[model samples]
Target: MSSRISGPGLGSRSARRAAAVTPLLLAVLLSGCSSGGSGGTKASSAPSPRTESTATATAPASPDAAAYRRWGIDKPLAAPPAPPSAKLTDGLKPGAAPKVIRRVPTSDKVVFLTFDDGAEKDPEFVKMTKDLKLPFTMFLTDDIARAGTGYGYFEQLRGEGNRNSINNHTLSHPNLRTLSADAQRREICGQQDVLEKRYGGKPPLFRPPYGNYNDATLAAAGGCGVKALLLWEATMQINDMRYAQGDQLRPGDIVLAHFRGPSELKGTTMTKMVANMLRSIERQGFTVARLEDYV
Candidate 1:
């Protein structure tokens, strides 16, 4: 979404279009891409399940165009696979189960990209997802999203036809391990109420800050209508991701990012961060999936 980047203006449409070529040729390397990790089951080496680019999607107009080569994506954007037919949630109730989840259990070449907090609300990030037609899962904290009415910014993303889900982090980005179970429930459920009032539904997922959680965190999440306590296999940085296992992205991994702006990125931008994420996925042969769909 990464094979080449030969010029400037990586943020410009023209620059992205300039680095055009079919990247499916690298699909064969997916089998040898990465070793399995604790983050869900390893995804299959095959990349055909999520194929969306038709034969008519000729050169220059590819949906997976190198428009984000500066961000590091070297492959065309392929749609993610549909919800798996069987998984951990097969017999569980819709609104509840499972504590301290790290990732889904499937061999499909699918990973979940989740953004946390709600710091920077960049319009360009919205434009980037819209322009690229990519999808992601958001675990939003109340204080951050409410800053300067930044909730409007997230609304813009939804208004523009992006179908990403919004989940709860907490009222404040607190470390739940230190809080009592009642306090944790308030943090988790308070944000759930706020999100449902704003985004139209209670979030099915909940993530503890810094991946910190305990037995109390799980019990609190269940009481607040949260079905899963999500964790991650990778945390995205300004330019690259810190993987829990090997350097490569394993299938079924859940990667984390933030709604940050330039100041937090050491003067870089979130758009660039996301672009590089797509590039990494391209290089590894994995497509992004909807987190709620899997759970």
Candidate 2:
């Protein structure tokens, strides 16, 4: 959830200098979510939240230069509307990037619970998963997903029959958007290759570090056999000492949480967050579903 994803043009003097001074930005974003069930494990150290944002920003600037020049126009491209829901597919075609899985269930009240950047699996989280029987989506990073580490935790989740998945968050958690074409391929495809080998199945989905991406970022993701660009519709943030996700949670909302920072991990401690999230969902009279099942 909170890891760095490197991209090109992010290593220059200006970028490095900016990076050094960018901690303040993280402080601003993380300070509010540092405690309670709201923080969770994906809540990496404060100021390091740039992990995903920096990577997603690596795309070549002036993406529409040629097109604009052709039309003798010079203005920023409009923000594209949300993509429609679609089925997941495998393999990459030339110039194709990952397609956005806008929301798993557009009509159901069910919520897709997702955790990112699992530093390690916590027994507490696992227990809660078993107790609640909540299905979740884990966007795994290479560090904890490796053999002899958090791998067993992943297996445990599957053994418990938790409706969840392990998708690529990138091998080193570098922001693929910031990397060069080669680096993007390395981060995207490289992680896919590793997860396939280590996890026994490659993920068909990807989440750019920090939910940040542009046209080029999406293209790169698609080129690597990633079909779905996963993003959240809502986030649980601290309201005083408790976590809140809007006035009333709804059906079909993708709620984001974390399990890779100072306070929590996937196995146990992270369960508190999931428990709270599940309770919220139940309160809304909606059930939790596997992202794959719905998407």
Candidate 3:
């Protein structure tokens, strides 16, 4: 999750100069936005396939009117600051290949579901996952874990029988493109280490925060043993809430949702968000399926 600071605090000529330089740097960072990377074939170390899908989503309502409003998301109590470690790197190196994963995509009846930032274990999510026997993938970040909302709460959900898998999302959620090569590896590999210690083994897939990453990010990811860098095909928002993708989403599409939020409107709990998504998908003539079926 990215942070937004409103109003003016830091200012003056130096601030303006710093701000002026940001866009030029941002251009470099944004260059990673392309679905294809340099030379296509996963850059030397053989980075995994990083396919992305884009959709036109109307920005949901701001979080301010959430309390009295029924259709908007509740604004985050305070604007979040950019994650503390969003630095950029220029060095590059190859890493290990993560385990090859398989999905049930050929069925044309199922879809994969992925959630980013396991900020907390929303009971509604646990209940829904259990009740529906849904399979959802979590791309975890240590900061979220350190924030006290780690995966410990969902031990049972991650057990052998459960269809959920916890993957690495980076120790600190940085825009991988912005960091130096070594720093990029540290972010990716460091999180993999964290996942291994906490989840009993390291994750095979890596997804950058906010879908952000550059070739350096991918190269570093490959060095860290990640076979595939996952991306989403679509995200659902209803009554201004986000949802678990597969619950009511469809086949071949990657569904994206979040663990916490700077809500589109206030009072928008995880419960309402998931509900909204399910309703939206069902209305679209498709159902959400576990990504395992796809690839």
Candidate 4:
């Protein structure tokens, strides 16, 4: 319009138009900014992409990953299969001498770890068992286990739920094969009493010292309420395992290890030795199973 408009009405209309356009302009600006404007100065509360990726990459995949690393294991140990419902005793009979077994009779790719004598009670080993939820059997000798704080040490290993078992080794670590019938009975039965009184309930399993046994030893064990005489298919030493027949582990093999420390293991801790043993088992694709669950 060529004509000039000068009045309060014209001023009011211009103000209204400006007021309406102001909101539209502001809304357009906000929409552009929210659409990832290059000049936007807004800071985000969310983590950056690189930070998120790094976090995911560094996170452990398993709850036991740290534990496996701490124990020098490359990977977490495979879990054993569910225990048999009826619990196979490997043809154990009642009212007779308990059957001696070097290995459990099963087709599963599992092996049993058993510790003997209870000579060295390393606190770390107890922690390891709890950390790994490891299952093993202990054959304790009265004289050795009861010695100077040894019983208390083993009591720590015997945690709740009875995940592990304590069986009779002997009153004294003696060659039952060399002892007389009465003497064998005394040794076997004496420890039975001690274990029953100390741990509660008679043990269903027994292992003669040095794996040396005779008819007299079996008879004594049976008389003392022992249901099975456990021997081993392999003996785990500080650095390696000694198999009875072959160089490899067989399914259901009972692996014998000791409650030993640096003194007995040539400066290797019991936990470290166990870690190495577990590595060997892992390498062979075998898993650890509870001996009590089977026998």
lDDT of 4 by residue, 119-148 (tens): 676788888877777778888888778765
Point to the candidate with the largest TM-score: 4
- Please state the error at residue 290 of candidate 1 in Å: 2.1
TM-score of each: 0.74, 0.62, 0.60, 0.76
lDDT of each residue in 12-38, candidate 1, tens digit only: 000001122233312211111122112
Question: Per-residue lDDT tens digits of candidate 2, residues 46-165?
Answer: 111111110111111223434423322233233222322342332324346554543443565566667666554566666545444445677776664653445677756642333466
In model 4, pairs of residues that clash are none
At residue 246, candidate 4 shows an lDDT of 65
lDDT score, candidate 1: 0.60
The RMSD (Cα, Å) of candidate 4 is: 35.6
Worst 10 residues of 3 by lDDT: 10-19
lDDT by residue for model 3 over 98-199, one digit each (tens)? 322212223354445676666546666665555444456777677765555445755545523445677777877766667898998998999888776765
Of candidate 2, the 10-residue stretch with the lowest lDDT total is 10-19
lDDT, each prediction: 0.60, 0.49, 0.48, 0.65
- The TM-score measured for candidate 2 stands at 0.62
